[model samples]
Target: MVYSHSQVQLYKQCELRYAYKYIDRIPVPAEASLHLALGTSVHGALEFLYKEVQRLKVPSKESILEEYHSIRNEQITKIQEENKRSQLDQQQVADFAHMGVEYINWYYSTYHPFDQSIVMSTEEKVFPKLDDDIKFRWQIDRIDTQDDTFTIVDYKTSKRYPKDTDETFKDQINLYGRAIKQNYGSKFKKLIAKIVYLHLRNEIAREVTDEEMEKTRIKYSSIIQEIIKKTQRRSNGDKEAFKPVQWYRCDSCPFKMICPLFAHNYIHDEAVNLDDMKPTTIKAVIDEMAQMAYEIKRLKEQKDSYAKILGNYAAEKGYKRLYGNENKVIIGKSENYSPLPEKKNELESKLASENMLDDVVDIDRFKLTKKFKEHELDYDQYQDLVKKSVSITAQRPSKLKEKEIDEYMDIIGEE
Candidate 1:
């Protein structure tokens, strides 16, 4: 049950995805987007450049940039090939490659390439758990010892930087800081955990406070417990509990077709002859429907109330007076109620006929807040339940007969 920050993030995204990727050993397709490949190439180049600087005390950024440029064409070609195979737009591939170059440039300019001394660049640093049962591991990007303090530097190519006030970033950085503390102990005078958002052209450095470390320790402990529970349930052959909770992000997920929610949606669409859906989206549609339902209910009530008031006003004015005659008292309902239903039915029928209704109607399977009673289960317990329910099912035995084996034995005949 080894877990890292990235694994934790994946689990939070979708337990079934984590199971597919890590537990079930499903192969994730190689990321072939220009942006993705360029990011990888840039990271590699930076690692190389920094390692050289660490060893030789100086490395030419211009030379590194030149080398990157030389391979840039090849990288673009590779990305284009991948895009062709994957059916990704060529424009997106080009955009991503350009962004990657920008990110590299950002990194070079921010660090002043040659000005900063590389204390430990691209080191394969690890943080092993203090407890033998908890085999938590983290490979930090770089550890730069500047002046009296040490900074754990992590490079990011994301366009947006996590705000300093963002809770998620706080948790992530704090966890990294805790890992550093747990591994290094008191070796460094001061430990600063920093995330360098290359694309955003900003850096965030947060000191490993005692409180933050404690929180990190508690968080990892809970994460480990959930992992153990998931493993236990997996070993016990509890398959039904492991159905994946379909989400909006599943659109980008490779296992969406295999996932129960997605599969169900796919089947419904095919059966009904529906239009092509976005494939991996579920939550957004559900949320939208929920909002629409709420709005519809609210609008109905509001319209009724408004109609009543208008009817009263018309009655007070006497229908003829309201209509500018001032003699006959005409009584009538303010507006028609049946029109709403007619419109709704018309839309529904059109969608059903076009087979687009299933895409709009398929609901999210995981309703955590609705299903679980408040304070009845903690966060870890809830996460464990999610993991337990999303375990990969075992394959059924084939019903077909076995093929006959042929043996080549001619020695006896020859004799």
Candidate 2:
């Protein structure tokens, strides 16, 4: 099994999705989204320009811009067939194009290749093997040697810096340091790694401490072991086990139509409605749904408390508001509205009247019951009933821990 930061992130998100993507080898169409294409083109252009500069070729800004334009145009043209008009607007296209240029310019300006001497290597392939049957392979964007230190520089196109401590970022850097040690001899006295958030215009740099590097090795080893276990399980006929975990990204997932959990009637209906909605409108709906879910949770809790209080005052004829205005609300018997028929009692009576009972046929079973007590049924039948009776809403996972954040940052550095 080969592991990368993205693979780890995907595994963390949903093991099934990771399985679908990597283990199953499901083909993903080449993304034609302008924003994604623009990012790729910009990275390509920068890589080209940097390599040229590394060779002592001081190309003018105009020449660099021209090369960027050529690459950008080619990419756009190649994706034009798949480009739905609604997928990207003129303004978005122009904005991404401008962003690509800005990123390239920032790369050139921030790290002047002409002035700096090349040391380790550019786009170096490093594969670190673990005790488990997993291989971690990553390509460094650029590695430079300065005095007694080895600096690993990774260029990022994103505008925001990761919201984490410097120590967390160092773990990622240390992985590169370890990779370097494994591949090259441990001749370098110091190892420095940096993630250049080009859009944010911030370079988060950290030096790997000895203790931190050892921790990184252990962490990577653990991850490798987990990956191997998952891979082996997948290979042993657990196909559905690799199903993509449904997340926010699932809405854009190519296999949404195939996913059993996310491909239900409600999700299908929502997908159809979403196709007709504007992006902003869809976003607004999502926000409203989040608020509604929170409100529902609060309302359910209040309802539960109210039910408890009502049980104590079964003889009472009035309802009282709790924790709000000190106003009393009365519940009176009503004759104007018809009451709903008791379906459970009707079914019970029908079953009793039939008198065709067997050991498995219990008349008392025909009652409205809570879901949690339905464990007598098989798992699949129980799941189906639960799906029909209630809606399952997903909440955002807990915040990334300090150590996890550092590991992610390290992977970003490698990227």
Clashing pairs in 2: 16-242, 16-243, 16-244, 17-243, 17-244, 168-406, 172-410
Full-model lDDT for every candidate: 0.64, 0.66
lDDT by residue (tens digit), candidate 1, 6-96: 7777776687788778778888766555666776667666776777777765566676676666666677677666556556566876677
Model 1 C-alpha lDDT versus the unseen true structure:
0.64
Over 4 Å off in model 1, which ranges? 67-84, 87-90, 163-166, 268-415
Model 2, 1-415: lDDT tens per residue? 6677567667777777677777777998765677667766766666666677667787676677788888888877777766545454678778889988887777677765545645456778887654456567788888878777777888777656666663444555677777777775466787777777878878887776767767877887785666666577568875643545557787677766557754432231132256656544433465567788778888999987886676456436344433337755343333673324767566556657887435325434334243333323444556654443556765642333565445445545643
The stretch of ten residues in a row with the least summed lDDT in candidate 1 is 403-412
- Which candidate has the top score in TM-score? 2
Candidate 2, residue 391: Cα displacement in angstroms equals 19
Candidate 2 — which residues are off by over 4 angstroms? 84-88, 117-119, 165-172, 266-415
